[model samples]
Target chain A: MFDLQGYGPSLLAGASMTIAVGLSAMVMACILGLVGAWAKLSASYTARATAAVYTTVIRGTPELILLLLLYYGVPTLVQDLASLAGYEIILNFNPFLAGAVTLGLIYGAFATEVFRGAFEAIPRGQTEAAQALGMSRFRVAVHITLPQAMRIALPGLGNVWMILIKATALVSIIQLDEVMRKAKIAAGATHQPFTFYLLASFIFLGITLISSLVQRQLEKKAHRGVGQA
Target chain B: MNFTTMLEYLPQMLDGAWLSLQITGLSLFLGFLLAIPVSLMRLSHLAALRLPAQLYMFYFRGTPLLVQLFLIYYGSGQFRHELEQIGLWAFFRDAWFCAVFALTLNACAYTAEIFRGAILAVPKSDIQAGKAFGMSGLLLFRRIIFPKALRIALPSYGNEVIFLLQASSLVSIITLMDLTGVASRLVAKTFAVYEIYILTAAIYIAITYMLVVIFKLFERILNKHLRTDS
Candidate 1:
C-alpha cells in the first residue's frame, strides 16, 4: 500500500504522454493503413506485392526489435550516409519519435488488414450503380466506397487503437518517461515495487476501460443508419 | 555477407532458440491446460469461481505483457527474503522459471478468453442432441462440448500461440538468453545492430511461418469430422 502522495502528478503526466503518443501513432497508422489497403487491393501485381511485403515484415518483426532498430540502427546508418556525403547529420533520433514511428508502423500493418476487410465489405453493386449513373471511378469511390468502408472499418480500427495504447508501454524501455517508466522510478524511490506496479496496472486498466467505452460509442454512431444484418 | 560467420553463431543462436522453444512450448501447453478449467469456471453458475477467473483475465489482458513480466520478475525479487524463508526461493531464483511463470499466466488469460468464446459459440442444437442421447456431466462434456469447442477455438488459439511465441522474446529482459537477448548481446559486442536484428527478425518470421503451417494443419484435422458429417 504505497501512498500516492509524491508520485501522483508524475504518473498523471506520464499518462498524458502515453495518450498523446498513442493518438499520434494511431493517426499515422490510419493514414498508412488507407494507403496500404488501397495499394493491396490495386490491380497491379507490383503494388499488391509491395503492400504484402510491408505488412508481412512489419507484423512479423517484434515491436521491441523495431524500436531498437529505428532508435539505434537507423541513426547510425543515417550518420554513416552523412559522413559518406561529407555533411554533418542534423536530424538525430529522439526516443519518443522513434517509439511513435515504430508503433505507428507496426500497427499500420494491422490497420491495413482492417481497412482491406472494410473496403471489401462494401457492396460491389453500389459501385456498379454509381458507375451506371455516369460517375467516374474516382467519383464512385469518393461518394460511395470510402464512406461505407470507413463505417465498416471503425470497430476493427478501434480494436487496433486499444492494442496500440497498451503497446506504448514498451517505449518506456527506450528511456521515455511514460507511465511504466515513471512507475519504475517511483517504485525505486519508495522501494515498493508491488505497490507502484499495481498502481500502474490500475492506470492502464482505467485507460483500457475508458477507451473501450469511447470505442463503443464511436461504433454506435458509425452504425446509426446501417441496419443490423 | 558470408556463410562462415553465420555458421559460427549457429550453435549459440540454436541454443537460444531452443530455450525460446522450450519456454513457448511448455507455457503454451500448460496455458491451454489451465485455460480449460478457467473457461469452465467462467461459464460456471457459481459466482465464487467465475468472478476470480473473470478478474484474472481482465487484469492480465488489460495491462501490457512487458509490464506484467517486469512486475513479476523484479517485483518478486523484492520479496526474495520472504520467499527464501518459505522454501519457494528455488523456483523464483531461476530466471527460466520466472519467465515461464509470467508467460504461462499471460497465455492462460488469453487462451481462457478464446476458449470461453468458443464454448459460447458451440451451437445449442449440439448440446441438445448430446442431452437427448443421455449424455450428462463429464461424459457429455468429454464427448460433445469439449471437442466441438476445441474445433471452434483452434484457429484463435493458434493465433494466441503465435503471439505467445513472440511474447517469449520479452523474457530476455529478465535475463533469459532467448533469441532476442542473444541478438542484443551480439549487437552490443559487434556494434552491428542492423545485421543482428535483421537476422533475429528473419528467424522470428521463419518460426512464425512454421507455426502458421502447423496451425493450418491442425485446423484441417479438427474440421475433418465436421466435413464428413456435412
Candidate 2:
C-alpha cells in the first residue's frame, strides 16, 4: 500500500497521455509503413531505392538520437531556410506533434520490414487468382491480399506496438507530460524516487501484458475459419 | 554548416563515444556472465527455480530501460539509509556504477532469454552422445551443449549487443557523457544542433556497422566447422 502522495490522478493523466501519443504515432507509423512496403515492392526502381534509404538510415541510428534530432534539429533547419526565403518567421515544434511524427518515422522503418515480410508471405497465386477473377488491383489488395497479410502482419505489428509504447517514455526527455515525466516530477517533489519509478515500470508492464493478451485474441480472430491442422 | 564548430566538437564527441563503448563492453560482459545462471534457472524443471527467473526476465524486458536507469540511479537515493547501513550506497551513488548496473541487468534479461532458447535448441542427440562418451554434468555441458548453443545464440546475441549499444544512449539521461549525452550538451552550448547531432548519428551508424562486421566474423569462426567448402 505505497502512498501515491495525492499524485495518483496526475499519474493517471500522464498514463493517458502516453497512450495517446503511442496510438497516434502508431497510426502514423502504419500509414508510412504501408507506403514504404508498397514502395519497396513497387516496380519503380527509384521508389525502392528511396524506401531503402529511409529504412536504413532510420534503423541504423538510435531512437533517442533520432527523436532528439527531430525535436531540436528540424526547427533550426526550417528557420534557416525561412531566413533564406526572406521571411523572418520564428519556428518552434509542438512537442506532441514532433514527438509523434518522429516516433512514427523511426518505427515506420521497422514496420516497413514487418509489412514487407507479411506482403511477401502472401502467395503470388492468390494475387494471380484474384486477377483471373477480373478483380481490380485495389479490390484484390482490399479483399484478398490485405486480409491474408493482416493475419501474417499481426504478430510483427504487435511487436512494433510493444516497443513503440515503451518508447513513449523517451518523449519525456522532450518535455512531454507522459508517465515517465509525471513520475519524475512526483518523485522529485516527494523525494521518493524509487517508489514512483517502480510504479511507472509497473504501469509499462501492465500495458505490455494487456497488449499481448489482446494480440492473442486478434490472432485467434484472424485465424478463424482456417483449419487448425 | 559551420565546419569550425563541427571540427571543434568532434573530439569531445569522440571522447564521449569512448565512454559509450566502455559502458557497452563492461555491461555486456557482466550481463553475459549473469545470463548464464539466469538462463540455467529458466531451463530448470522446478517451478521454484524457473518462476523467479521468468519474473526477472519479464520485469526487465517489459519495462523501458529509462525507467530502470532512473529506478537505479535516482531511486537509490530513496534507500540511502538502508543502502548506507548495508555499505552498498557507495556503489549505488556513483552515476557510472548505476548506469552500468541498470544496463547490465537489462541486458541480462534479454540475453538470458536468448540463451534459454539456444540451450533448449541444443540437440538431445548431442547430449546423449556426450553422455555415451562418459561425459556428464559440467563435462557434458562444456564439451557439447555450450559450444553448440553459443553457435545458435550468436546471431541473436549479436543483436542484443547492438541493442545494448543503442540502449546505452539512455545513460545520457542519468548525466553520463556518452555519445548521445555529449551531443546534447554540444547542441545546448553551441546551438549547432544539426551539425553536431548529424555527426553524432553518423558516428553511431559507423559504430553499428563495425559491430555488425565484427559479429559476422565471430559467427563465421564459431560456425567454421559447418562450412561445406572445406
Candidate 3:
C-alpha cells in the first residue's frame, strides 16, 4: 500500500494515451485485416502471394523492431527525399504515430489469419442460396456471409485486442509517454521502482479486466442469433 | 549490396544471430521444463497448489513481457546493494542473464497454459486403461498421459518457440547486442536506417521460416506413433 503522491494525474494521462493508441490501432487493424483476409481467400495467385508475404513478414519481425524501423527508419528516408527536393523539411514524425501504425501493421497480420479462418468457416451453401436467388456476389457477401463470419471471428478478435492493449506499453521504448514510460520517469524521480511498477501493473490489470468483460459482451451479441447446437 | 560490404558485416551479424539463437534456445528449454510442473500444479486437486499456480499464470499472462523485463532488470537494479551483499548481484549484473530470466518466466506462463490444455485433452479412458493394466501415479503418467499430452501440445509449443525467438529481440533494450541491437546501432552510425532494418526483417523472416519447417517435421515424427496405434 505505497502511496504515489501527486503522480495520479500523470499516470491517468498516460493511460489515456495508451487507450487512444490501442483504439486507433484496433481500427487500422480491422481494416487491414479485412483486406488481407479477402486477398488470402481470393482466387488470384498474385493476390494470395501478396497476402501471404504480408502476414509472414509482419508476424516474423518483432513489434519493437518494426516500431524502430518506422520511427527511426522511415524518418531518414523521408528526410533524404526532402533534401533532394531542396525544400526545408520541418516534418517530425511523432513516436506515437509511428508506434500506433507499427502495432496496427503487426496485429493486422495475425488478425488476417483469424479473419480468414472465420470467413472459411461460413457455409458455402449460404452463399449458393443467395446466388440462386439472383443476388450478386457483393450483395450475397454483404447480406449473408460477413455477418456470420464475424461471429466466429469475435472470440479470436477479442484475444488480439488484449494483445494490442498490452503491446501499447512497448511504445515507451521509443519515448512515448504511455503508462509504463510515466511510471519509469516517476520511479527514476522518486527512487521507488517497486511502487511505481506495481502501480503500472495494477492499471494494466484494471484495463484488461474491463476490456475482457466488454469482449464477452461483444461475443454474446455476435453469437446471439446462432443456435448452439 | 556489394559482396565486400556483405562480407564485412557477415561476421558481426552471425555473432548477433548466434546470441539470439542461444537466448531463445535456453529460454525455451528452461521454460518448457518449468512449464511441466506448473501445468501439473494447475491441474492438481489441492487448492493450495492450484491457487498459486493460477495466480502465477494470471499475472504473467496478463502483463506485457516488456514491463516484466523492466521490472526484473531495472527494478532489481534498484536493490543492487542488497543483491551484492547476498552474492546474487553477479548474475543479475549481466544483461544477458536478466534478459533470459525474464523471457524464460514469460514463456513459462504461456507454455504452462498450453500444457494444461494438452494434459486435460488426454482422454480419461486412456488413464483408466493404464490403471487397469496395473499402472498408477508416475507410471501411468509416463506410459499414458505424457505421450498424449506431448502430441497435443507440440503444435502450439512450436508457435510459442517462434514467439520466443521473435521476443528475444526485446533484449536489445537491456543492452544485449543481438540482431535488433546491431541493426539499431548500424542505423545510428550510417544513417542508412531503411537498408539495415530491411535486412534485419529479412533475417527474422528466414529464421521464422526455418522454424516453421522444423515444427512441421516434429509434428510428423510425433504423428508417426499415433498412426501406428491407429
Per-model chain B TM-scores are 0.95, 0.97, 0.95
lDDT by residue for model 2 over A1-229, one digit each (tens)?
Answer: 3799899999989999999999999999999999999999999999999999998788778989999889889889888788889988777888899889988998899899999999999989999999999999999999999888888999999999999999999999999999999999999999999999999999999989999999999999989997691
The candidates, ranked best first by lDDT, are 2, 3, 1
Would you estimate the TM-scores of all the predictions?
0.95, 0.97, 0.95
Model 3 Cα lDDT, one tens digit per residue, A36-107: 999999999999999999998899888877888888778777777888888767556788888889888999
lDDT of 3 at A12: 86
- Stretches off by above 4 angstroms in model 1 are A84-91, B1-7, B226-230
Best by TM-score: 2
Give candidate 2's root-mean-square deviation (CA, Å).
Answer: 1.4
Candidate 2 segments exceeding 4 Å error: none
Q: Candidate 1 docking category?
A: medium
TM value for model 3: 0.95
DockQ of each: 0.63, 0.89, 0.65
Query: Can you tell me the CAPRI class of model 3?
Result: medium
Which residue runs does candidate 3 get wrong by more than 4 Å?
A81-91, B1-7, B227-230
lDDT of prediction 2? 0.93
In model 2 chain B, the worst 10-residue window by lDDT is B1-10
lDDT of 1: 0.87
**If you assessed candidate 2 against the hidden native complex, which CAPRI class would it receive?**
high
